[model samples]
Target: MNPPADADSPARQIDARIAALGDWRGETLARMRALVHEAGPEVIETVKWGGVPVWEHAGILCTGETYKAVVKLTFARGAALDDPTGLFNASLEGNTRRAIDIREGETPDADAFKALVRAAAALNASKRKPARR
Candidate 1:
């Protein structure tokens, strides 16, 4: 049988996932949240697909999750990003996804993360162009 979705599902999932990290997970998630908020005021936090914490300004900009040894940052439109920092991880079929896999207890590149957020915001905003009159 399938389970029903709940409002706090995302938060619960986040807590559970972070808890699996044993320690430092809270700090990492906190930093990730700050990064998204600092990116722009329009960035809204929501419980999106797969019960994940999604940051959306124009669309799904990024997701925060804690792994056993790292925190995962997934950008929805990452493939289209310029990503000069080479911070993406190559997934299946040589596909590079715009993401930063920060170590569970390590400090991330704040400047780089901010830059990526700005870039993502720009990209998402541009997609909202008005129709011709």
Candidate 2:
């Protein structure tokens, strides 16, 4: 059986998810979501594929997925972006998607994470730019 959908807007849905988690995963997702907003204030937050938090600007930037052991942030075009801080550790085998798996008691570098968020937004924006004649 499935749970009832959360009320109102996407933000509310995400909030409900975080509240429901009631654990470290909730706090981690909330913090990461804040970073995503700080990096790209114009991003639109949505819940996709059954309550996964997706942040989008010109296109999908990343997704906040809560699992049993780790809170994974998956970037849609992360393979194209540079990772000087080595923030991305999971899903490295993929050609298009990259993910950072944050486990309990672990901390992610906030500034570097925000930088990646901005970079992903920039990449999405570049795609929407008009082609030259």
- The prediction achieving the highest TM-score against the true structure is 2
Candidate RMSDs in order: 6.0, 5.0
Residue-by-residue lDDT tens digits, candidate 2, 10-105: 888888999999999999998999898888889899889988999999989999999999999999999999999999999999999999999999
Q: In candidate 2, how many Å is residue 19 off?
A: 0.2
Clash counts per candidate, in order, are 0, 0
- Write down the lDDT that model 1 would get: 0.71
Model 2 / residue 92 / CA error / Å: 0.3
Q: Estimate each model's TM-score.
A: 0.73, 0.91
Error of 2 at 35 (Å): 0.5
Q: Cα deviation of 30 in candidate 2 (Å)? A: 0.4
- Model 2's alpha-carbon lDDT is 0.92
- In candidate 1, residue 25 scores what lDDT? 69
